[model samples]
Target: MLADRIPIADALHGKALELVHEHRAASVPLLERHLSIGPDMAEALLLRIARETTVVRRVQSGLYVYTHGPIGEELAALHGFAQEVLVALASNSVDVDQLRDAAGRYGFSIPHQAAGNATVAVPLCLAQVVNV
Candidate 1:
């Protein structure tokens, strides 16, 4: 059978996704019971699911939660920072320093790359923030 040809690890991951999305639960113990897997295997499969997809996140010790989106509607307000930064950029002909300050005021610290020791990096997070 083609389904039988699939490896157990991959099959476990698929079933786990189905269960999480269907039931809104990612309980390791539940998966262990359903799949006839022990705790260690269940833990490993859960870790694999997390690394391969964003559908599940460990919200507490030994507890996993299913997430429908990367960020929920409750965090809708946080996106304002990105929007505000974009507005400031669109409204200004500001220099690099001003841009950095504007982004900082919006609560973002742009990442910097160093070419030499003790050198401050460029505030290139400007591009990231705008895209955000």
Candidate 2:
């Protein structure tokens, strides 16, 4: 998982976010395996985390995909930027438009249809962190 290499938040919510971000799309079993969390724990985590994510309504049953949402208020700008970029690029390998779309998180849409909502500027700028 990509997130396994990236920094993770000490909180369960943060950890869960990283997991989904890494995998792009994830199932309950995937979360449980990576986090060593039980089904109940995964469910609880999903309930809260889903708000900041985009789940394919009719695709994978438990597939949870992350998007920078309100619940993500606790995450750092750098990390959140990574998550948003990953989610945008999940469906399509290299989509620069996805990064610019929505500004990166508004809410749920028909799966990949959502490219809205930005990471809500806090401090860290995506360009500043990336080197050309």
lDDT of each: 0.59, 0.52
Best-matching candidate per lDDT: 1
lDDT of 2 at 93: 56
Question: Where does model 2 exceed 4 Å of error?
Answer: 1-10, 52-132
Clashes of each: 0, 7
How displaced is residue 81 in candidate 1, in Å? Answer: 9.1
Q: Highest TM-score: which candidate?
A: 1
For model 1, residues 1-132, the per-residue Cα lDDT tens digits are 232233456666888778777777777787788878777767776666665766766664757767556453223323454465567778874345555555555455556557421211223473554432
lDDT of 2 by residue, 1-132 (tens): 333233334497778767777786556777799999777666666655654444311125545544445434434334555776556556555454455443345331213435652333423454333210
Q: Which stretches of candidate 1 lie over 4 Å from their true place?
A: 1-8, 60-62, 70-132
The 10 consecutive residues of candidate 1 with the worst lDDT sum are 115-124
